[model samples]
Target: MPLTFRKSFQILPGVRLNINKRSWSITTGGKNGPRHTHSSTGRRTTSMDLPGPFGWRKTRKGGGH
Candidate 1:
């Protein structure tokens, strides 16, 4: 498998957001076994995905996420 790089931001003490800048794909028996492409549309993740102090809450412009 290929490795992925990401940048993360901490909105709160235990809350975080992640951003990825690339897309990845894998193929078997192809000229290129794996391929990675740079993308402008990135992915995002938040601490709300896990069971923790964070929940489905609205965030203000300069507040939580």
Candidate 2:
């Protein structure tokens, strides 16, 4: 298997900091609510769960080359 590294720290309620081999990100939200993530690599992600086995997600890149 390929080497991998990832860790997460809870900064506050509904907030966390995630670190990986390539980048770091901040996540905010609860499991039942909409969540958002902003990465050091200039990528942003938003996700939310539905009533059933469904979910919603969106991704938007930052102003970077």
Candidate 3:
């Protein structure tokens, strides 16, 4: 959906909004479809477990909280 905005001032705690509606259609790919993929040798090289929320910092600095 597309929307447009207009300028206006508020006095006593008021809110303003703009709304727009749109029509959607599917193309040749169809609505929600998965893409193609290549197969792997099943080496299991990656780790499935990691420190929860702060995983990003651990990659750069070398430790987890």
Candidate 4:
């Protein structure tokens, strides 16, 4: 199995800093609101939670997904 590493730090009430082996990202937003993320590898993502198991996510990256 492939191994992965990740960690998150809460900077503020609605802000977070996430780090992985290859890159890092900052996310801002609340649970009931739309969340936005931008990574160090030129990836931008916006996601939102829905009523149940349904949710929405859109991601754009400079290199590949």
Instruction: Please list the C-alpha lDDT of all candidates, in the order they appear.
Output: 0.34, 0.93, 0.23, 0.94
Candidate 1 residues lying further than 4 Å off, grouped into runs, are 1-5, 22-65
As a TM-score, model 1 comes out at 0.26
Q: Write the per-residue lDDT of candidate 4 for residues 1-65, one digit (tens) a residue.
A: 99999999999999999999999999999899899999999999999999989999999988466
Q: Residue-wise lDDT of candidate 1 within 33-61, one digit each (tens)?
A: 32122223332222122255534422233
Q: Give me the overall lDDT of model 2.
A: 0.93
User: Any runs in candidate 4 off by more than 4 Å, and if so which?
Assistant: 63-65
Q: List the residue pairs that clash in candidate 3.
A: none
Best-fitting candidate, scored by lDDT: 4
Candidate 2 local Cα displacement, residue 42, angstroms: 1.0
Model 2 lDDT-worst window of ten: 56-65
lDDT of 1 at 28: 19
Task: State the lDDT of candidate 2 residue by residue for 3-60, as single tens digits.
Answer: 8999999999999999999999999999988999999989989999999999999998
TM-score of each: 0.26, 0.86, 0.13, 0.90
Off by over 4 Å in 2: 63-65
Candidate 3 is scored at a TM of 0.13
Order the candidates by TM-score, highest first — what do you get? 4, 2, 1, 3
